[model samples]
Target: MNSSLQLAVPATRNRAPVGPPFRRQARSRLLRADLLTVIAWASVSFAVALWLADGGAAGFSTPAGSFTALGIVAGLIGMDLVLLMLLLVARTPLIDGAVGHDRALEFHRKLGKPSLYLLLAHGALVAIGYGIAEGLDPVGELVALWLLVPDMWLAIVSIGLFIAVVVTSVVTVRRRLPYEFWYVVHLLTYAAVLTAIPHQFSVGGLFAEGTWQRWYWLAICIATGAALAHYRVLEPLVATARHQLRVSRVVPEAPGVVSIELTGRHLDELAGSGGRFFIWRFLAPGMWWHPHPFSLSTEPVLFDSSGRGRLRITVRNLGHGSAQLTRLKPGTSVAIEGPYGLFSTAARSRDRVVMIGAGIGITPIRALLEGTPFEPGNATVLLRGHSEAELYLGDEVLELCRRRGATLFHLTGPRSAGEHSWLPEPAVHSGHRLASYAPDIADADVYICGPDAWARSVISAARAAGAREEQLHYERFDW
Candidate 1:
């Protein structure tokens, strides 16, 4: 096995900026992450406080009043949690910068079942409380609510919608459903929230005419809507206009792999390191609506202070949208959202670095090789593929590693079905592990990009090799 490629080849020139790449503070990110946690919990606490401020304590003394008061608090907390979920996924810069877009999305998903449960509890408690007050059964009171109360029917429908959303979001169910179908179902959350809001103001005793609770709820809903519109809608439009990215050329890298080069104005102002990502929407027939999230294969190269430069993304025809991308023509306009993810040096916590990439996943590692700073022997690169051609831009990577003084290893062979190691068949037989290439991997920040299962294998090996959680970084790009 030719695993050890020549280290010191003829130095090839690169387009990276002269000097160290941009630096990010791990401390700042941790502090901001902490702040977000405090705020999320504090919002729930504030909801309870709002209830306490308005005779909530005295109402709980009587059994019927107690059920009514608890119902009100449950509704408030459920509403708060729902709103927080929306804000988490609004693609807000604050959340993305603090916890990264993926982590924010993870938090968003975790709240689904809890928020649904709270809403269900709110409805049941309110029905029982009202039934006791009116000397009717809970079912009779619920029937009266649906028939007589304004917007109560809509609230009932909202509960059904919330149940549908949560059921589809469960891991097993989500796995069986197509993503588009899941997305459409999840969008019903807004409809559910809107339908439920009317009863909060119209029927709830706490939010009676011109009460502080009414305005507070109104403000939060408005703010959440505004944030969603700005970040997810307006910001993409503004960026499309400001940068004006257009396809310059499309170059085929290997079978099923192509690189799309895009040129735009002020590309240097793009606020991300080489390994970060952007969600791209190419404006063309049948393709303009589909968004593709891809990391830069090459960082932007600005020629002058005018910020006129080019950016490139290497794509493999993994799906329908990417297959369409491989056929893109020159001069096609593009709209974008982000430069998000923690796959860059912004995630670095140590001086040394180890980068691992398998198959087409090596593209982002190539960009990182060009832009990240490291001393001659402080960085290591491992490329895993079934063959050399599967390396997809292996030559360029080798050049970059040589120019940047980083070690490079090529593990190319068939898979080993026995042990399921991330290394190739030959390497697995030889007992090579993640630490074999980069012995200091435990002290280095390890960046991995690849298929989900393969990346998970790499992660497991890295962990077994003593790599800390914070020291290992990877991005899961799901649009």
Candidate 2:
């Protein structure tokens, strides 16, 4: 096993700012998808309601139809409630550290808009359906609506939550808020979710038919409540009490790269393999609110065999929090959390290994090759760069290959069709490389980590060559 490790010193550099939504994939297209999903959900819901109402005939019955409608509305209301709560819990900074801020943001995007639409549909349907049944004038119906059916209050709360999610999702507005402030506001989602549950129980449109419906609602209530407690209240508290991480040293690496070493009680608990990432929060001056994901560039061992473990994370200064990391000096306390993700040597264990890296994404692949135990001649490192100058850490990788007895292939120009094949670089003979190497791709496990475009290509190439989905592994860090 290798013992000593060294990381590059950090240096400052100009970085392009991250614009709204990160990359430009016109909002109009995304809105179109969202609208389609809304229409689908509403249609499915109405279909289910029509079936339950016995083809809309029973819908006219007061006590009977109202009870059935109550069950449908309440169940839908409960689901929306629970979803909103989970979103809020996920926004907490401590929890955010577990998955990283970028991933959490992505999750919000997937679930947020649809959730708002579902809630609105549920509310509008209930109001209109109930209004017609009561046979009252528009003004009187609006005034005495909640008086006759108090569950509308839950719909009111759901509306509040929808507004909150919309406001937070806006890029220009959210950027102005502090991380802690945003976290607090996000917690309101839990309250909204819980508040909606009672409405579900009281208005049993879906739940009135059988004991199973009540049981299902009860199950949802308990499961959602438990998850909220753990993610929001319990998980972070455990990190604080158990890990108690503090940054022991910060060394400047080459431009855009910084080495951060952390120490805490029971470092053995913190020991993890290479390529695994952690959500790090440096709370001290000069490091604040930059809770982003970083790859572990060093082995997970106590400072020494007899001491606590130390971790080295190489961060490429991409934006706000990342740029500030270059200014960190030793003894600047940090709350190191997470050992999340599964992009490691274990995923690469096979007769032959092929690794690819783009720009700073090479950090994790570097650790997997260097920190982990491996036999010689089993793995090959193929590194591609735009130019020799852009090669972030090629020397270290070559040295690692030399130590492990693996071959290193470097391509420092624009990639071509057959450049990756062992056949002559200018001409890629796809069959020759496969036959000479692992003829049966199903027997080989491929691990890839890097930029989105590069990772996708790797996956496509592997699959095209007949690699099983289970036999291929990858880590995607794209925002």
Candidate 3:
């Protein structure tokens, strides 16, 4: 209802040069990613090196000794991997800024299975090695250890918890379970890590007190825990209290989509770039515990002289957690964590820009188009949907394109029947591709958001049309 609430762009007609600054930022991010990769591998190497320094290699001279040595190595690497996974999901700004939150989480998911395998191997091999030395079978040795060792039972419980967490996380099983159910089970990961710690310090001779290995392991574990607490727990509380956000209004955008607006203090400071998202927790009964990551549908609007402003996020009823958002009433307090991801103007590498969105994914594109800097006629907007009704906020996107002198296309129709293409059925049949919509796409920065499969198709098309990986910015909608 209020057109003025849309983002305001500078009235300048001159185009800002995009070469040097864009390259510098892109190079910086690449370096950070490279550094993180190095650090992760370095940690694993250091763990092995610590054992070698303590004469671990000499243990490999015999069959039983070799098994024990291998088990020690497996445990060390597995624990290191567990620490890395924690840091990845700790919401640390360094990781988030370097690779984006979604990519970081993807890496975390990948490490889960490998880490679990190593841990399981560690337990089995250790039991076999001990059994051979004591003239008993592995199962008998395991039972004896459980009965005789001080912390073996806790270690066994830790492994069981790890198995449950990893099993529920598999894609097939995860789809069948409720998000909350999976989330609660995932929280048991902390308990698993804690339970496994006692044996490492108290039973393992490698990390005995006063040794450098002990100090090194202790430092890494403590740092990981501290980071999790500060970023995942303490930081959200601080941000919520600092912003003092409250629901101002809720406006329906489409059949199942709604825009929830909020007013808060020092909004400009918290105002993330267009296309960036924040994890919002509405302090309402039965819903306060679920955090929803939604992007701004419009830029934050600074309303008065005292730094108070309003921001809005458009969401659809895609899941149980998000379905409850439609019932949100005015004045409900909000807790937030982020402004994360790289699908914004900050990732631009060229003056020319192309934005493509499908269904509710069009919301963030609208926000990005509002405030991102580009010359008149240098930007292109493409909205794809099965029908016109699915193009939520179509009118506003068209208005913004017209005012900014950018080309706009609304591609509405059923998807291609037999092939995996992002274009509509007619366009695909006619051999019209991304290049047909934006002829200079190779020289443009392409931003895409949509369902996972559809977005992947779009990305493939862009790459085939000669767009560089650094020039393609994609935000996943189904996180």
Candidate 4:
């Protein structure tokens, strides 16, 4: 195993000026987030308004009637939410550019349980309400609906599939399953949606033939599906053919850590700031079906005259899926899905920037240091690891810091025993903290990537040092 310490001396140059340009970009991102929030809530309101306009409130005069009316409302809203969740994860460029792929997925995860609950409640309440009207028990009514109502059986199966999807998605359950197993189960979500659609049109009176409400619901569902098809399927195929990325070589950086370099056509057009990740699929047998999200460890180098460029990503074997990547041969075709995440220059809100990373997470910081805008002395990079070798790409990061005039610190050693901290034991014992390394962290944009718990600790230290939430940018390594 490789274990050693390397650090770059801090540059004595003056800091860069903080100007209107960075602040303008930050404000624009903020606006986009706000707009997304408004649109989501407005959709729910619109769903409810459709029923209200159809005189849905009159049915609430009786207890059974009230239950049935509320059930209808719940189903409408729940279905709308399901569509919203699909759009959020559809890789829509507007949403990806606005909140980034990671944040959009975060919101998508948050909606999962709630949408499932709303759907369950809609089923139960509708059954109970109808049972009362028919002088039958809830269970009896459910059976009757499943057996006698056209398309209702499919709806019941849809609910069952949704339950399976959500249960498998629970953190504990998900941890027990292989990622491929979990992914296969997740695909049932589309089947569930399709199964549920028939009952929505056939049984729901609000969506009967010639109704405007039916048209609106159909449009939303079609749009969500189109977005998924276009962005997730078609766009990737087009990009794969257009770029023609092929693995040029794989160079080991450390034990189990390697950098995969690719040569592609018009690569500069796909280049974003460093630290942004792309979802890559190697079109080789056994691995062609699996996609890996890896950040570029170096900026794309383009030879303008030839429209040919090279890109590189440093990866460490962290799981079975990634371990297979180490064996990939030269000339392997690669399909890409993004330059996602906001952990790049686009997220910079200040003249000074501080990059913190641990273990394999140090790779993206290396890329950011090379490409993110910063005056030589205005950037500070802190890398942490249990051993120097664990700090993958440390030498390259150190070299970049030196050439770019940024300060670099390598914190390598065992963890602190007394407190929950990201610093090494020696540094922790000596009273070093995040603020100690980057004294102006309060005014700097702090970009952090690492293990979940360790990253949280660093985030806490940064917050304690007066960094606002908006000033902290993080890319989570865990899916």
Give the alpha-carbon lDDT of every model: 0.85, 0.58, 0.87, 0.86
lDDT of 4 by residue, 243-312 (tens): 9999999999998988999999988776665998889999999999998989998888997856699999
TM-score of each: 0.92, 0.69, 0.95, 0.95
lDDT of 1 at 468: 88
Better model by TM-score: candidate 1 vs candidate 2:
1
Error of 2 at 456 (Å): 2.4
Candidate 1 wrong stretches, greater than 4 Å: 6-24, 209-212, 417-420
- Model 4 clash tally, residue pairs: 0
Candidate 1, pairs of clashing residues:
none
Ranking by TM-score: 4, 3, 1, 2
Q: Summing lDDT over every window of 10 consecutive residues in candidate 3, give the lowest-scoring window.
A: 1-10
How far residue 268's Cα lies from its native spot in candidate 4, in Å, is 0.8
lDDT of 4 at 294: 90
Better of 1 and 4 by TM-score: 4
Best by lDDT: 3
Residue-level lDDT tens digits of model 2 in 243-307: 66667777765667777877666666655457767667778665555566787776655655554
